[model samples]
Target: MQNDNMKCGLIEKTESQFVDSIEKEAYVWCEKNWKHDDYEHQHNRAQLTFVEEGYQYFHIDRKIYLVPQHHVIWIPSEKAHKITSEAQTVNLMVFLFKSVFEDEFYQNVQVFAVPPVLKEMLLYASKWNQSLDENEEQDLFFKAILKSLPNFCKESSSLEIPVPTDTRLIPVCNDINVNFKYNLDIDSLAEKAQMSVRSLQRIFKNETGITLQKYLQLTRILKSIELIDTRQYTLSEVAYKVGYQSLSAFTSSYFAIMQVKPKINKN
Candidate 1:
């Protein structure tokens, strides 16, 4: 699924050229196992990406979202962000649309479930790319998809983890992400941040709107998801790797946070 420009190592240049030259109201592009470089960029038209297989990580508004299979990532026009994935094989379908609808859903970054109908529409739209003519069949089809988005995209995914902004809490958050396998108690984190336990709890709650203990749980769950996606480790191995002493605890916590049972693909 590598395009000509991509095979020639000119993906960025080709995208810029298309954005500058294309005047159509809609565009669609499909790829397989595409690995975009690590950089932030934005577009004049709003963007929607459907993950048909594997998963993708989106960095938006200082938060990280891991969008798994059968999900969509929406980014509004002019919103700077970066998308990355560690999966070896990914099937992605991206759509770019002009700001025609006034729905608030189009104004923010969101990762949400993809309905069956939307998934079919995305697959059909994959036949066209770069630019679609106005009032044409492809254009009209995409317009209908955009009009129906708000209704279908109501329930957002809970796989997002917000990055702390406070200088004192940043390192603490970083340590939890890096050393999630270890037991990260309040005393250790408080000492690492050079603050009293009481002060750390107050500021952490104020900055991230979640207790430190809850944040640790979320970090471990999200990390577990990433590990599970790799399919190289069994569920028990993943649980231990993410700091859960028992598989039952890991499964319960994952279900509590994601509202879905974790699935392992060891093929």
Candidate 2:
């Protein structure tokens, strides 16, 4: 049912319902309404979420990835996940099924960091969604994108925390964002939420699939990397800004999580 405002984000239309046949093992459609939703769920088919605009938080496992404009997050089949829309932004997703992905389904479900080539291909495919079976050229185009899906896989280890859809969690999440520098602890956070520490941990695990401490460490690490890459902060300053008291500890954590030494990616 369309809401009074008439906004929707999760589109669930089938081939017969939306478009004509595209090719064997593949179909195409659009999600006209991407709205604010709460909760985490996974599907039986590996799917592609192509965000044409706006921002959101994509939760898989227990790590949180901040999805900004033109970013797409792919959720593997049966991997529990939740998504929260960035305030007042359009959330777009292009879902691909397992058969279309072919043999690459053996790899882990990925939230690909979409590059230009992938973006262009998706845009082109979206345009032809209504033009399925137009010609042999259309068949080739579909095949090309199907092959490239594996190439879009990105290496992301940390997952986002899944907060329950509740008024209490919202303030708590906002507080975490605001006071990121302070020593983050479960007890303090629970105090803010007016809930017991155990309760907070329980829901956080249910939503994000990881411990709160682990999620916080990942969040700090991501923040540190962004600052370092900007060429504005020295590694030392970046360390302190992200709540790491010692550079060595920070470096160790960074290397352990990302499996790469900290250095500017100039290219």
Candidate 3:
């Protein structure tokens, strides 16, 4: 509801919802930290949301995705989802009209690497609001941006952290998401959910496509990535911050999952 134009663009309302004032093809909302009102909502247009400074978490269809900086989240039209962040974040969000791109490419929710060229174009395009009337020069730029999408948007699966859909397991899932640092044992989690350990194991794997142990480890690693990027804590400190008991154990786990060692650079 609070919209600051910032010489980037203006916010416009359509059907009681606040959306970026779009041009013929797309509209961009660049913000330091955008506070959204609705918990879950759908749009008639697809979106490409890129983080400019930090990371964001998105929940869609009972699954969660960890979207980091310089990555693009491609959300198709009519997909109901919600976004959140552990701290204040900055993002460059672009909404594209459904007609602007091919259906096959934009039909599903995906996270991709944002190529440099596309990043520049989006930042430049964010400066102007769309109009029904476009000059030849503006039209050329719009077309160029559209053509560049395929090159910049390469689907990535590594960052997706699955969340369970079952109502019974929802509480456990939420716990791991928010409290990844807690000592979460499978037996204790199952007991807390009022289900037997074996039953919980089966249900968790069936619904989330991951074993409980893997999910917890994945969640911790995702949190570690955020913490390491902050550069405020040493690698050892970050490991403990995210619930690992030993630095060696945390390093091994981090390398196994991330294919890289946890390194912090203050510079």
Candidate 4:
């Protein structure tokens, strides 16, 4: 087992494991099974874990990423990490060597949402990986698969968690609006929507690829900005109204979620 800190020896599976094989020595196919277990592995090759079913929780440094169906997590070559999944989750991985994607991929590891065409193509490849024999079927599936590879090579921020579908989060969001300055904790917000904090956490992750904390911070800051846009309150007053006790706290949160800082003079 590889510790979270140590970069493990490389794990390789034959290209026959993937439905689509690149004619070049750019990638390899592998099946990863981490059901209901906790393990952390790091590598020098950028890896894509495609979730076939169930859910996966990945922690990079201390940030948690939820991987559900229709999504995949990209782990960069050097980051430290840990992943935990419950029973019955199946993940398909296509581990691409650095020599393959070349300089196109980003240095960071993150999740990308699979769109329609790519999803079908991957499903075809996965089924193909399992059904076919390992031989040089070079011209057929190889070329077709490789062309799609480069397009997907670039990182996309569009991949994200779906919004919380729970009947509660919306109302709870409303409650937050009505009582923006309450300084309420997540528990209180969850209770208003009749959900436990853990349940809230999972649903929120499923619906929005980001975490609850990030979303909450975004929400509070957005509210503060909207009110401030009217030019009615000073930055300090707006910050307090949005549940931020300290103006510095509000500014930091605002900048973290939205790349832009809040304007003290919106007029």
Best candidate per lDDT, number? 1
Residue 196 lDDT (model 2) = 98
Give per-residue CA lDDT, model 3, range 108-146, as digits (tens).
Answer: 788876777877876776665334355676567766766
Off by over 4 Å in 2: 1-24, 31-33, 36-45, 59-65, 78-82, 91-93, 98-107, 130-135, 162-181, 185-214, 217-267
Clashes (backbone N, CA, C under 3 Å), per candidate, total 0, 12, 1, 6
lDDT for residue 98 in candidate 3, whole number 0-100: 42
Error of 2 at 56 (Å): 2.6
Estimate every model's Cα lDDT from 0 to 1.
Answer: 0.79, 0.61, 0.71, 0.57
Q: Positional deviation of 160 in candidate 2, in angstroms?
A: 3.7
* Model 1 lDDT tens row, 1-267: 345554211244634332434566777877788777577766667888898888888888888888888889888887887778877788888887776588787887878888888888888887775443565888788899889888888566467777778888988998888888887677888998899999999998888778877888888987886788888898999999999999999999988887778889655
Task: Please identify which of the two predictions, 1 or 4, would achieve the higher lDDT against the true structure.
Answer: 1
RMSD of 2: 7.7
lDDT accuracy of residue 157 in candidate 1 = 49
TM-score of 1: 0.88
Candidate 2 lands at a TM-score of 0.52
Q: Give the better candidate number (2 or 4) by TM-score.
A: 2
**How accurate locally is residue 137 in candidate 3, as Cα lDDT from 0 to 100?**
62
Candidate 3 versus truth, CA RMSD in Å, comes to: 4.0
Write the residue-wise lDDT of candidate 4 on 3-34 in tens digits.
33222123223211212233343343545554
- Expressed as tens digits, the lDDT of each residue in 80-122 for candidate 2 is 6667753344547565554554475434555545778988888
Instruction: Quote each prediction's TM-score.
Output: 0.88, 0.52, 0.77, 0.44
Candidate 3's displacement at residue 52, Å, is: 0.6
Worst 10 residues of 1 by lDDT: 7-16
